[model samples]
Target: MSFTLAIVGRPNVGKSTLFNRLVGKRLALVDDQPGVTRDLREGDARLGDLRFTVIDTAGLEEVTDESLQGRMRRLTERAVDMADICLFLVDARTGITPTDEMFAEILRKRADHVILGANKAEGRAGESGVLDAYALGLGEPLRLSAEHGEGMDELYHILRPVADEFSERAEADAPETDLDVSDDAPEDFTPSAKRPLQVAVIGRPNAGKSTLINTILGEDRLLTGPEAGITRDAISVSLNWLGTPTRIFDTAGMRKKARVTDKLEKLSVSDGLRAVRFAEVVVVLLDAAIPFEQQDLRIADFAETEGRAVVVAVNKWDLEEDKQDKLKALRTGFEKLLPQLRGAPLVTVSAITGKGLDRLHDAVLRAHEVWNRRISTARLNQWLGAMVEAHPPPAPGGKRIKLRYATQAKTRPPGFVFMCSHPEDLPASYTRYLVNGLRDHFDMPGTPIRVFMRSQNDKNPFKGRKKAPPSKLRKHLQGRKAD
Candidate 1:
């Protein structure tokens, strides 16, 4: 395992900015607000040739009350405990505030390895604040400008020794391996066990996405409460579910585009979309009380359009009084609202009580298998012939359109290509007919299918050739004989 570094400090001190710089992407949401980030976001960071796992944590607050700020502080403290080193950042422009002093003292007591970094230490503007940071007595602070890309070399110099020590420890802890092989050994063709399945849980605000994940993990690993939009970044957690290793991403609740006006919310939504694109399977969490809302439909449609395997998880099932009727209505409404995902799995579960979780797990695995399914070319052509015979192509302008053959182009959403005489003449309705046929006949329920048409080019070889005057001579001879 790589070394872990946690960035912890009071809010709005450029911790996320430095995180984005090190990770080479803007994975965390950053804004002028004090507590924009509310979760622990992890990313693999690189500095020069040094690589390590870096965590962007919520700002620490000096509060022990059961308020939101206190919860966030507790989460950050957990991150500090998990990290190999903590990078405590302070805003040099604002000087050392009382909050910073309180956090510094906390880190001194809890974390064994701490590196004090004075951010925004660019030009002479922050010289006084940098000097004030020395009073904390942790050590001489490393002056850094996270926004302007300054002091990175010094940061690297300080991190190199730590990285080397981690590498040495890992090498010493690793067990030795010994194996003997024959000179002409046959290669194994059986499919090896796949890597952990990447699944992302997504939904609107207060839909219990984090709560559902925490239930799956059987622990309070994620911070959850009655607050809407509690999760701001896409946080990933790895776990073994029934002997299957899986990596689950808990994302911020995505609101409608029109309602998303805040810059931080926009960034959070974008991050959620990125997680969807990266995931192999996405679970669209819906509130059972008000299911299939406009935003929920939009979210499901977006996932289908992205060619991802989708499973609808209706949360808060425990709150419903009428179970049988609600389940029937939910199924009917789901099919009616999102016909694109016609047969997608709809599993009802109460994230708080952990009911129906087993069914949800099975549905997710089944959807993933269907998403990765492949069909043989012969079977595809046979199915295509049957489909074409059942519903012949439309003849427009008295020109008959012929679909020659079909072949599977790719899997993982199951794409196919059809050779035809006139590709453009094929109507959208007919294309849908073929796609639906593939989905139904091939038993590929709820999986997105792509069908492409290709027209054959048939050109005449003897074009633009002029004929001799033999026709005129033959006509004259025929007239003379008739006379």
Candidate 2:
């Protein structure tokens, strides 16, 4: 269910007013001030049968600096990234400002998933702005007056198909229960209490990697401080982390490859990479002040690329002055940048104060569980049927890529095997769609999903398609020979 909608426009375009109408409540603060909404506010919105999450973000501005307007602009961009669709509103009363044209260009270049709307188009006065909207090349803008709720039916009509598409995905995720999945595919993983879940914590230097591990362990076992790159080896610590037996590895600070001239630092970084490869779950910790730096994205992407379950933790969150805005920005940034870890858990924590430690612990456990999850072959094939029906395999070069069956080959970073015709001809996009489907259906969020396609090796000529029946004369000849 990925039907998220973000209402974005210039100040007083009636975004918050329309947000109030959709949610059927005055949830957001409405003021004459342009930047009344500095923080992104989300509420359950309804339009006809479609129920979705609608984000009311700060108005879009031309500024691109450290000023309040600039920050709001950046946050709005992130909120747009977080949404599946954006309802780009423009003031019809003003009749399309030059800023509106600029914003339209930006939305076109960056966010193609936009539904244009001309707010305050309740009568002939709004008709001019509505026609002017056509020049924006964002399709016919929905004429509306958010103040009086004039064009909600049109809004519902536009949102209905989006709602149905997401509904189809939700239906694919929830299958019939009468499916007996025991013998078709054996369970890939069986949880063992004796075995400790292998977890590795990796990040840039001075990101509180050591301190975070110590906080989880409930002791200052590893070294911590202001100094960068203190730990030189991949240190392993055994502890019952919140009733779950876990063997956590405290990895050294992974500096950028260009800066790694020191021989010891190279060895330390290499050792940390090894920890990530061996670990079942990887926690990419980031210093809240400098979260999602180039190195941080690389580290997080590395873990995911290595097929390990990943959890992103924003450390030192206690230092943030405005928690709500920062969190909204951080999560939006997370989804925007690390899309491979789209549904992965992101926890904000303070290692020094032990704040959000419980949330971190819970996220780790949930990640591990998802990592080792196994789906039966019977259910998998059923899911495959639904997925192919919902989004058929792409036919390239006038030949169809037929996906025959699906089975779980391995778990602990769950991998699936698909028996299909012309496996090599399958497009990467379709494969990604199925992987995403598996994640959405089986509740395996943020864990790396692997799909391997193999050609069907059936030897029988009539293996799949029906063979024509033998003639009666041929049958009589065979009977005579037998007599």
Best by lDDT: 1
Clashing pairs in 2: none
> What 10-residue stretch in candidate 1 is worst by lDDT?
185-194
Give per-residue CA lDDT, model 1, range 228-333, as digits (tens).
9989889898888766678899999999899999888888889999999998889999999999999999999999999999999999999999999999999999
* TM-score to true structure, per model: 0.92, 0.56
lDDT by residue (tens digit), candidate 2, 1-483: 748999999987899899889999765656565555555667789887788989887788889977656766887888787788999999988998989999889888777489999999987888888898999999988988899989899988988887888789899998678866465655433234556788899999989988888888886556555667766657667788778778888888898899999666676688789888989889999999988999999999999899998999999998999999999999899989998998999999998899998998889888988887878999999989999998888878889888999899988779999999899999888888998888898998899988899999868877788777889999999999999
lDDT of 1 at 58: 88
On a 0 to 1 TM-score scale, where does candidate 1 land against the true structure? 0.92
- Whole-model lDDT values for every prediction: 0.90, 0.85
Considering summed lDDT, which 10 consecutive residues are worst modelled in model 2? 185-194
Residue 474 lDDT in model 1? 97
